[model samples]
Target: MGGTSSELRDLTNRLYERAEAYGMEVKTGKSKIMVSSTTNTSADITMNGEKLEELTKY
Candidate 1:
């Protein structure tokens, strides 16, 4: 999903909501967001009231 930050955040939020409905949850502490581009593409993608960390490189 390589799109604008807002798009990604929206997709993430929808995903989290669907997962929650199925009795599943994303462990935010072990979750991360990675952008393929070199430029910054960060957005407030929160799950379970916690913002996910961004992975700079990996």
Candidate 2:
């Protein structure tokens, strides 16, 4: 949804903070970042300080 990595990172930060505020756990095990680009840019995207796994298929 974000146009840049930083923007996407910011969104994750907000999501993590909000979830913590509500006492909800963001399951990192079920989280993933699927990139359609030819370059690896989503390695920086994370949830709750843990990097999200990138999938090539599904």
The models' CA-based lDDT, in order, is 0.77, 0.76
lDDT of 2 at 57: 32
| Candidate 1 per-residue lDDT over residues 8-44, each given as its tens digit | 8888888888999999987889988886666654556
Q: lDDT per residue, candidate 2, 1-53, as tens digits? A: 56676777898789889999999988998987666566754447888768888
Q: In terms of TM-score, which candidate is strongest?
A: 1
Model 2 shows how many backbone clashes? 0
Residue 16 in model 2: lDDT: 84
Q: What is the TM-score of each candidate against the true structure?
A: 0.76, 0.74
> How many clashes show up in model 1?
0
**Stretches of candidate 1 exceeding 4 Å from the true structure:** none
lDDT of 1: 0.77
How close to the true structure is residue 25 of candidate 2, measured as C-alpha lDDT? 89
